[model samples]
Target chain A: MDEDAKAVATALARESAADGLRRLTDLLLRVADDDPGLAAIAQELDRITEELDQITEELDQITEELDRITEELGASDDGRRPVGVDPVAGRANACAPPLEVWCLPDGTAGASGSLGITYQGPRGLVHGGVSALILDHVLNVALSEQGPAAAGGELSVRYHRPLPLYRNFLATGRLSRGADGELRAVGEITVAGVVAVSAARIVGGRGVRM
Target chain B: MDEDAKAVATALARESAADGLRRLTDLLLRVADDDPGLAAIAQELDRITEELDQITEELDQITEELDRITEELGASDDGRRPVGVDPVAGRANACAPPLEVWCLPDGTAGASGSLGITYQGPRGLVHGGVSALILDHVLNVALSEQGPAAAGGELSVRYHRPLPLYRNFLATGRLSRGADGELRAVGEITVAGVVAVSAARIVGGRGVRM
Candidate 1:
């Protein structure tokens, strides 16, 4: 498939807009630059923001309705209904670098995405928290369906080396049952085939590692 | 100060554009809506992408120069130079919720921000990894000057309860010296006066918690 089509298939929804959001993020990082092209973007954004402000003000009339609809969607009796936007791998979430996830034959979950300056942490590296975000999402995805409710557990992250920006990275995960009978999802972020950050999401009760 | 000026001052730089980027995010979440107003944003983004495509193509000319400048900025004898964008709290970083951080008289580091659907995690709540992101950034910020190099060690996060969206939350951190002489930054996320997540950043060598 074409790249556009692929992005469309990849994102859960609003792929064009989300891609645009990503580009906007990239451009904003250069805003401090003295470039005239960058200034044009600043002006364009002013117009867009003005337009959005007006629409949103009118949108306030339907605010209650939207909230009601959102509530109905989130109205799970079990209190675990997903809020639809996954901050790391969920395509629809603009906050996400939105990794593309797939599976290996052994059921290991795999995700791939290129880190940019937007995910920048200290200086040229991806944020430690961003790595945690990716691993947490990918491991949970790799876990069998048995562990959805176990998603909100403690995450232990060991930063072996700083993950860098503007590099394509792969994150892979597999589920293992701990000795204490709790399920654990373990994963790593690899740049150019080397592990940079390794993590494990311990589901439920702070159980021991597998 | 007025709200706009306050946002400007609170942000280290590029406050207007970052805030605009954020509003764009809020608008994108509602792209699923059939509202005529929402359609305008989609159309506007299409125009934006076209314009950006042109500018970025020109930007490719300076790509090397930008990279050179970025390299100069990132160039440090030691490998720990910060990349200048903080994903959770850095005002200049569009990816950040861009929390406002300040120091308490007692040397506690404090951060305040309201998360939105963009940072949404599992259904109807903040992403688990996001809490880790906030705590990680805040803790690193909180630790006294002794621990900058120790920032990337390890982060342990325990989710006491789900941190909700569209609500204001505060994360606070303080430095604690471990018995082994390693430093640890301890902090928590509190919403409406309730602790939803607690975290500790173990600075180096896998030191025990203080």
Candidate 2:
């Protein structure tokens, strides 16, 4: 296969692995009732610990093998994308909650996804930072499609309500063109028809590094 | 052992597992220069993918075992911290980057940590949302130490420069008391003596839910 095809396949495999890990993370956060006697719980815990240890050992071996491969490859840092396959926001990123976006005729964008316990914070609510991350990404997507890529200069977010986990959420971003060639955007995250979080930001003009 | 001790041990084990996964994630993002012959690279990638598949299968089994245990225990959802062991900020959480916090006598809080490729965004820079996450957590910690738990209401962040990944960074939060019983705080994230991000937020009072 060509280099590009190989790269794509590697990314896909990595993303799948990430998805598996994400699912495991969600399971880890789930709380079990105190109904089970301490002894029974302890036994289960012990079993789980043993399994985790085995997994860790396997991972260690993989890391060593990867290190050896790196040396054999005589790898040198290249300017080709500082973050080769970011674990977040990359279409193939496993760490990010799956988000699907649709562009509107007027140049705005809409995104929808469900965040699970892996993204939970503050009781049953989604982490405030996670909300910001999704909103920021969507806003940038809207801007990138319109004109030159820009970096976020300032972002202000208001939490109107808690964004719940394990439920579908919608996010939208709209770009406003400025006369002086500056770009600004506003984004909102809504859950069940309620606007949970709202963000507004100004983007520096072209040549700005994010 | 006792129930409390059992809980602690379980948390520790989960954290260790998370840590292992975190390391694997970092390794996944590190790109080897295109020095290795494509055949060699493909062979290694295939091996890694196979290992990942095995690990994922093990995780699936673990999850099933956990589910069975939960059912046998007659677990019911309780107010007992939905996320029994947070993989993000919990001391026992292995997924989170190591963060150390020191509380000052003057009511401010200081935090230090290094972000890795797992949190990379925007061309090797730390994710903007991650900066907000750590800052928000520190601010809440400062507030909680002073009084009751509060929730983030509004947050404003200005990105003066990109936050670099895989480097030591400093974060600090200071509280501003409001005579009317409101809580407000300001925080900053700095790298190499340069301020990269500054944030300020108003937190809801006693009854606030984040």
Query: Each model's TM-score, in the order given?
Result: 0.71, 0.84
Candidate 1 to truth, TM: 0.71
**Backbone collisions counted per model:** 9, 0
* Model 1 stretches with alpha carbons more than 4 Å out: A1-13, A31-84, A103-106, A208-210, B1-13, B31-84, B147-149, B207-210
**Could you give candidate 1's per-residue lDDT for residues A42-110 as a string of tens digits?**
444344445434433433433444444445444322333222346776565567885687767675987
TM-score of chain B of 1: 0.67
**Candidate 2 regions off by >4 Å?**
A1-9, A31-38, A71-84, A101-106, A177-182, A204-210, B1-6, B32-38, B70-79, B82-88, B91-95, B101-106, B177-182, B204-210
RMSD of 1: 7.6
* Docking quality (DockQ) of candidate 1: 0.27
Per residue, candidate 2 scores C-alpha lDDT tens digits across A132-152 of 777766776677777775465
Which one wins on TM-score? 2
**CAPRI tier for the interface of model 2:** acceptable
